[model samples]
Target: MTDGDARLTDICSGAAGGKMATIAEYYAGKNVLITGATGFMGKVLVEKLLRSCPEVKALYLLVRPKAGQSMQQRVSDMMTCKLFDRVREDNPDFHQKIIPISSELVQPGLAISPEDVEKLSGCINIVFHCAATIRFDEPLKHALQLNVIATQQLLSLAKQMHHLEAFIHISTAYANCNRKYIDEVIYPPPVEPKKLIDSLEWMDDGIVRDITPRLIGDRPNTYTYTKALAEFVVQQEQDKLNIGIIRPSIVGASWQEPFPGWIDNFNGPSGVFIAAGKGILRTMRANNDAVADLIPVDVVINLTLAAGWYTAVHRPKSALVYNCTTGGINPFHWGEIEHHVMSSFKRNPLEQAFRRPNANITSNYLINQYWILVSHKFPALIYDLFLRLSGQKPQMMRIFNRLHKAISLLEYFSSQDWEWNSENLSMLMSQLTPEDRKVGRPTKHAARLGQIFNILQLTYEPDC
Candidate 1:
């Protein structure tokens, strides 16, 4: 560990040398506020907290009505998901502990009702702000509304909370991807967030879209750019609030917790795994040796809970950022992932493959484009023609178009390497009690990955 991280451990432990409470003990009887409870990581955070900290007083979920479902209905449906089966078995009335607060993150004041606001201000002990627009192509103005503005509003609300102990913000490890090396500190913003927000408010949509490129500068897209700004916004509140920021890299499948091989966070490698298993994706540009940095969702949640406890209990003077990545330690490469995935598919292949399971990756741009034309477009064109002749709507080309867009967005991260210093995570884990870290040694990533891949055979989606 670096001197900075070693010092952090000391601050977390202190010189009293007293017996510290375990993670569950600290969270007992605490009222927790969680935004984005319906999201991939947010749901896992909720499940883990309920399961690990069984005595937690209540969970207040900030949710919105979507697809005609009310906030209460959404929370009710979420509680019944297969993801919560283990929690259900452990505590059949787990639903009683959840209280949904109507909130639309993009709206002013988060659109939270006055009653809900008053309720939250009086009893909330800890908060986890996990909501953000993760779309790579999301418009800059809309992205700012949800990621930056909503965060500011939430921070303001936290100031009113009489019992609030800690606030943990979720950010991506690629927030500072412009740099080759990233440390456990928020970098200077690309542009001042307040200034940019002020400018965008007066401009029209087209003007904002055109100026976004100049504003974001070297960052790949609005997602990373805005996430970087959100960190700064969170940092600004350090004096008034105990804050901890967790930056996770390419969140992958669940590790051992409720169960191994559960696949909920499918936005990462699972897309490639499923598409390739169904024999759709054949080739893409990726550096074979680049560290993939696929941190499991379960481990990320564990680290998140640990950080929440540390920030609330130790009360660090400065806001601590935890780069919750696996690149620096237990390094895994893209080539190893492709090998394991392909091997698993061959053994227990998906029932319906568009072609024989033979997919490869390339580092060369020209070679990848060549394969895209020959392997991707050519197959889609032929398949669409067959469908047209059979009186079926030709849809292969549309699917391929979406696949190409996804690949274009993914290749930037896949074709390069970024080093994230995760000493803060190590320091946080070092202070946890044995029960908090009681899972079996999980060094056999190869086997764990094989289990995940084999399970994917049963989960191949026909839709792109």
Candidate 2:
């Protein structure tokens, strides 16, 4: 067999042993820095590192004060969220290890003070960059500021870190959405990063909005465009820094660790699944057969830590890129997702559901709109009428309308799939010990199916 075939076979076999031990061993006693710790994936990465690698030195989290809260207060509240229940149980004082630094990525030099920089440069061993603007409708200038410029600044800091072992940048699999098949290697960005940043600096928001369609060309939005540019910027550090990139497709709920079906935000498929499960969304435009590419958060985090280990240990001449996706290994279609989501909700029904969880995806726009009126609007209207007759406020229809709007914004991802080469992911897995593989196998595919079944059972349960 060829080396590639041998690597594939090893990964398939390692699936039985799990991969957590190697990851745990690698992160032990390492001082790590993470950005975007308050976001979905970032939170998971922080929790997993603390829970699985408890001996790690410390975790420096860059956080900006929001609303009226101080940086310390925000980080404290974030740790108390339900998402950290597992970690709390395992290590009751896990929050003590998280050092919150007041730094805003959009600010000049990412707003990191000289003292904080000195501290990081002296002690930090690894950095995970997970911060990015995921908004599909974010203004071009704002997205570029957060995604592209922030990355450039972070690379400069990484260069200054005397003890830095690896720098992992979390990028989206859809960064190169214009192409159907995406390889592990970096592609030349559509526009030069500096040129785009300079042009947007002088343009007004209205002007940027007006020309966004033309500027993006075949790509759908500014989010992907900025992400692609960020990848290019990260690649520039390959010669001097031990860098790795993890491009995960649409991130979803936890498949195994912590708990099954644990999701917090209303982005990507999570919003649609929750909206549909609540019986609020009835029709959406999507290709049933298109690969959904929905990866579990735990799987992505696992691959990320593994990549960090590989970059630090191997120090390869080329920057490693790991396509953390499921399509190539276990292809699942939107049609199946729709079926499972509806079934799950039917069993574990939401607090207040609309007409049973009966949403459908379609390719034809007209058909979808027709169902939106008949299946969605009509039921909501009838439900509102009943509530009005009972002297109650009519609110169900309004909520369904908002849900429909949210789903409409997310259909673009569901209607298409991007193929990613994961050769590096395979290589990283190969370097793990047999014991490590046993703990990080990700429950295989059975756990995912079981979670869907449990969701269905909960939705339809009479008491629920």
**Estimated TM-score for each candidate:** 0.93, 0.89
Q: What is the lDDT of residue 241 in candidate 1?
A: 100
Error of 2 at 458 (Å): 10
lDDT of 2 by residue, 324-398 (tens): 777887777889888888876776778776657788999898999899889888888898999999999999788
* Top candidate, metric TM-score: 1
Q: Report the error of model 2 at residue 299, Å.
A: 0.8
Q: Which residues of candidate 2, in runs, are more than 4 Å off?
A: 1-22, 380-401, 434-444, 450-464
TM-score of 1: 0.93
Which segments of candidate 1 are over 4 A away from where they belong? Answer: 1-18, 434-464
User: lDDT by residue for model 1 over 157-239, one digit each (tens)?
Assistant: 99999999999999999999999999999898988999999999999999999988998888999999999999999999999
Per lDDT, the best of the predicted structures is 1
